[model samples]
Target: MKLLIGNRNYSSWSMRPWLVLAHFEIPFEDEVLLLSGDGWRETLAARSPTGKVPVLIDGALVVPETIAIIEYLADLYPDKPIWPADLQQRALARAASAEMHSAFLGLRGHAPMNLRANHAGKVSADAVGQDLHRVETLWGQLLARSGGPFLFGAFTAADAMFAPLATRIRTYGLPVSDTSTAYVEAIYGLPAFQEWLALALKEPWIVDDDEIDVIQGRVARGTLA
Candidate 1:
């Protein structure tokens, strides 16, 4: 399997499945496309129908969308516990993954992930607040039920799904409960996540569109403490 992704620093969509593959000890070669290039759109359109980052190419099959990639990889490696082993837990994990895939637009728009930049920021819009609250409740419930350092007690696909959001919370210093903070730290400490972060910090590429969101808020990213 060959995974095609965008920049390590700014591409959250690319980060999800990459982490999953890495954590599971999956043997796959990854190709990185520097985003925001002059021909970036053309590059994506040639491979992906949606013209997006993180396209998985397995043999002749092309898989777009992070959730789809996860599903494909999980099915291919049923021996591996991609999702939870338990039926009920697997269902909840899938639900959580789907929710993470579609929800949180406001948080995403206002708090773009930039591993290199450390700034405290806040979103003034009510929609962002609603998303934030949803995250707190959603995460709090999952953690309480699982009794976990991870959403499902172990690092499953559900953990991969929310990994970027964990980065976003830390990147923007978003207000989250102690439970959520602990969950973020658990993800941060994962060997795969640490590897990803180390690679992200070394990248010199910059996307102006992603970086410009930082100026929209005056809140300090990590200085509020």
Candidate 2:
């Protein structure tokens, strides 16, 4: 299998399946496209049907979209315990994952993921602020259900789905409860996630659009630590 991803620094969608693959130790070739520079759409369109990163190419199969890739992985590796063992838990996890995949536009817009830097500040927009609060509520509920370290016990696709949001919350220093803060820290400390973050810090390319606070004259954090 060959996994196509965008630059590690800015591609939140790419990080989802990438995290799943890495966390589960699934073997696949990694392909990266620099999201910056000329004709990025043309470049992506040539490879992926959706023209998006995090697409998985498995011999005859060509899969696009983050959730699709994750589901494909789960199907392909049925014994990996990619979802919860309990039927109800798995259903709830899927619901949470789907909610993350489609909803939370405000949080996503205002808090673009940048693993390299931390820009601590309040999100001024009413919608974005509400989104932040909603996330806190959601995290608290999920963490309570799972009882720590990950959204679900023993990391699953659900955690992978929300991984980038953890980075976003920290990067923007968006307000989160201490429980949410602990969850964020636990994610950051994951070996696979830390590997992604380390790679992101070393990338030469940067997306001007994702550099939201820096462009607006806020002090940029020097490290992801």
Candidate 3:
């Protein structure tokens, strides 16, 4: 299998399925497609049905979208515990992952994941406060129920779905409860996430659209080095 991903520093969507594949010891090769450059969109279009990052290519099958890729992986490896074994738990996990896919626009808009940079206190609370509250509530309920270092008491695909949100919470210095803070720390401590983070820090490409400083006019678009 070959997974085509965008730059590690800025591609939150790409991070989700990659973590699941890596953490589960799945045998796969990855190719990094720089998200910027002349004709990059055309390149993505040619390679992906949705013209997006994180497309999974397994022989003749191509899986696009993070959740879809994760579901496909879960189906491929039922013994791997990608989702919880219990039917109810699996349902909850899928629900949460789907919610992650569609909701939280405010936080997503204001706090793009950038593992290589920190813009502490620069994000306005008003812009993301409602979404933060929802995150805290949802996470708190799950953690309290599961007694987790992760949502389901182990690192499942549901946790993979929220891993980038964890980065956003930390990178933006967003205030979350002790529970959520611990959850974020747990995500950072995952061996797979650490491997991704290490590579992200080494990346030279910058997507200005995702850079808070560039969007806020604090840094010129092409000046980051």
Query: Of the candidates numbered 1 and 3, which has the greater lDDT value?
Result: 3
lDDT of each: 0.86, 0.85, 0.94
Where does candidate 2 clash, by residue pair?
Answer: none
Backbone clash total for model 1 is 4
Which one is best on lDDT? 3
Q: In lDDT terms, how accurate is model 3?
A: 0.94
Point out where model 3 deviates above 4 Å: none
How many clashes does the backbone of model 2 have?
A: 0
What TM-score against the true fold does each predicted structure earn?
Answer: 0.91, 0.92, 0.98
Candidate 1: tens digits of C-alpha lDDT, residues 34-73: 7876898898788777888899998989888999999999
Which portions of model 1 miss their true places by more than 4 Å?
122-127, 213-225
Clashing pairs in 1: 119-221, 120-219, 120-220, 120-221
Q: Which candidate is the best by TM-score?
A: 3
**How many residue pairs clash (N, CA or C atoms closer than 3 angstroms) in each of the candidate models, in the order given?**
4, 0, 0
Candidate closer to the true structure by lDDT (higher is better), 2 or 3: 3
Ranking by lDDT: 3, 1, 2
Report the lDDT tens digits of candidate 3 across residue range 14-132: 99999999999999999998899899999999999999989999999999999989999999998999999999998999999999999999988989999987789999998999999
| Alpha-carbon runs more than 4 Å astray in model 2 | 125-127, 214-225
lDDT measured at residue 90 in model 2 versus the true structure, 0 to 100: 92
* Least accurate 10 contiguous residues by lDDT in model 3: 110-119
